[model samples]
Target: MPVSKRWTVEVLIGEDHGNTSAVARLDTNDGTHLVGAGQARLNPADDDIPAIGDELAAARALSDLGHRLLLTAAADVAAVAEQPVHLTW
Candidate 1:
């Protein structure tokens, strides 16, 4: 059987006092409810550059979100195996 589902992700970006910040929120539910929040910031030495800031912020936010998701997965696996998970890759 083939199964599929949809997850929603929202990324918000903003700049304040020479600091560019971004936050990514992901919502997933598969008989289990889980929400993840990822945040990132960039302090540019030069003037305001929207393109560069966006790229940096978005990349960082995604990286953070990925880390959180991996952590959750590891915890789940450890719970089922009754042992801690140590991923090497």
Candidate 2:
């Protein structure tokens, strides 16, 4: 069967006291949800750049989400194959 589905990810970022954090939420459309988080800390000696921090945090969060998705897929494959499975990027 040929099928197509749309998945969306929402990223939220916050900064407090020079610490920036981001969260990425994934909606799989199958009632399964996944969340990934990342953080960035500004150095006192360095210039404060909110955009840079947000970029780093968001990138890390998305990376984390991708890894988690891989793990979930691996587990599902293992369940159907009746064996332990390891997925590689």
Candidate 3:
């Protein structure tokens, strides 16, 4: 049986105004490219701008990871259904 795998690439960018954004790309062997891109605006409540930026970046990264995992699981299921099975005794 042939094995299929998923690859994910993520990028996090921070703006000068304490805003952070993330872009995630998920690639699978079945020629599927899933994208999960988002932006996070930090609230300057009591935290400093730098601290807010860090928190926003972390939150964005988690969001990207969650999206990528969902896409990968979906791709795996689809690939399994489409792949041919061969058995040898």
Candidate 4:
């Protein structure tokens, strides 16, 4: 039998004082919730580009979320295997 599952991630972004920030959140069916945050700062000598900032912040947030998920999976695997586990992307 094949088992199927669906997961979703929501990203929220905000900009303030030439700084951009983002948060990525994941909610799993097993009632597991994970969150990751990221930030980007605009240099005074550079032009203000809102889109770039948004992209950077969102990308970082997603990266952070991915790292967390990897760690969680490693822990779960270690628990089942009765040994320490290291997972990599």
Candidate with top lDDT is 4
Tens-digit lDDT track of model 3 for 1-89: 77577565655565666566666665657676656566667566655566556556656666766666666666667678896433322
- The whole-model lDDT of each prediction reads 0.69, 0.93, 0.62, 0.94
- lDDT of candidate 4 over 1-89, digit per residue (tens): 77687678999999998999999999988888999999999999999999999999999999999999999999999999999998989
Q: TM-scores across all candidates?
A: 0.75, 0.93, 0.47, 0.92
| Cα error of candidate 3 at position 64, Å | 5.8
- The TM-score of predicted model 2 comes to 0.93
- Where does the lowest 10-residue lDDT sum fall in candidate 1? 32-41
Judging by TM-score against the true structure, name the best candidate: 2
Expressed as tens digits, the lDDT of each residue in 1-89 for candidate 2 is 76688789999999998899999999977977999999999999999999999999999999999999999999999999999999998
lDDT of model 1 at position 42: 47
In candidate 4, list every pair of residues with a backbone clash: none
Pairs that clash in candidate 3: none
RMSD of 4: 2.0
1 versus 3: better lDDT goes to? 1
Higher-TM-score candidate of 3 and 4: 4
The better candidate by TM-score, 2 or 3, is: 2
**RMSD of each candidate?**
3.1, 2.1, 8.2, 2.0
Enumerate residue pairs that collide in model 2: none
